[model samples]
Target chain A: MIKVLFFAKLSEQLGTRELLIESNNIKDTEQLFQHLLKYQADWSGVLNSQIWLKAVNQSMTTKNVVLNDGDEVAYFPPVTGG
Target chain B: MISVQKQDFNQQVEYNRLKSKTSIGAIVTFTGLVRDINQDQRVSDLTLEHYPGMTEKCLIDIVRQAKARWNIIESTVIHRIGALTLSEQIVFVGIASQHRGDAFAACEFIMDYLKTQAPFWKKETMESGETKWVDAREADQQALSKWNLENKC
Candidate 1:
């Protein structure tokens, strides 16, 4: 299974903080995001927002980054802290 | 060293922890405070949220990058999370080096990158009892761009 995380406003909109997805067929962050879209109607709208940002395994990454089992991925809005 | 905690930090304690040997002649410290006002709104308090594991990794990466680009001898960073009231200290960065230039430059570099690269987010509570997630500022992104451009050549 792959671990998925949401933070800040994204977590509020999706109403979920964590999820575990079956590792089959998901190859990259983009694919995982698409897989998540199936579970919630508002996921697409919130994720597609201009301020959305992502991280894979605690590092900032683009959507094309390849994923592996047990990897932790996070999606959230742009950060606003010192 | 980097710490992300909900507890308030003592600046003098953090400063002494970063003090280096005799060869290190300069120390620079910066503290970020929670403002009571922002964009014409009166902010009463702030709620800070961070991606737990990711927050530490991001901060460590930023510090590593700073060390790679400067001759820094010692450095420490402490960031507060969770609820914070007006005028409370929110973040502290301390750096020690042999020269003033490297100490100053590295301290600023870490802060600039940390502002954009870290996972912490802030939600502000206004005096009217309304709360809103603070928007990311373009100014912070621009601050990061300068470093990227300088390092390219």
Candidate 2:
């Protein structure tokens, strides 16, 4: 199980701040992202947009980063907060 | 030093705290207030939300970036969270530098970046009792772009 969180515009569009995904063989962020796409249509736009950032465990990460059991993952729009 | 919290800050105390003995000559201060109007609409109050641990660390990182760009003697930032009434203080920024120019520019620079890059979200209450989230302004984005361009140069 991996916990995924969204914020701001993403949150409003998806109507939730957090989501849970279940996978036994999902090994990397790319796989996690592919899995996420199935859950919502709004996510597809953000994922396909240019220059959006990704973070895992509070640090910025790329799509290829690996995940483990109970790991936290977050996706958001271009982080335009202050 | 940076803090993102729900408590109001004392400007004088924060100013004195940032003034060190190491060649400090100027202290620049900026205080942002919750105005009665936003987007030409009469506003009653505002509720600010922020990421708990990440917001504080992000503020400190912004201050650290200012330090890298200038000869800052010291700096302090206090940002208020939670619900605030009209005419309430929202944030404080203080910067100490060897010269006034660096203090002024860095102070403005930090505030500019903070407005766009920080994780704080504000929802405003209108006179009709409606709540609306504020959107980021294009000017704020352009303000950050100046530093962005400078970094690459």
Top TM-score prediction, candidate number: 1
lDDT tens string, model 2, B1-153? 777778888877897798866689899999999989989999999888765666676687788888998889888888888889988889889999889999999999889878876677787899999988787678888877888734310
Which segments of model 2 are wrong by more than 4 Å? Answer: A8-15, A23-34, A40-54, A60-70, A76-82, B149-153
Candidate 1 segments exceeding 4 Å error: B149-153
- The most accurate candidate by DockQ is 1
The DockQ scores of all candidates, in the order shown, are 0.60, 0.35
What is the lDDT of every predicted structure here? 0.86, 0.77
Write one digit per residue (lDDT tens) for candidate 1, span A18-70.
99998889998878878887777777776776567878887776548988999
**Global local distance difference test of model 1:** 0.86
- Location of the lowest summed lDDT over 10 successive residues in candidate 1 chain B: B144-153
**Measured with DockQ on alpha carbons, how good is candidate 1?**
0.60
TM-score, candidate 1, is 0.94
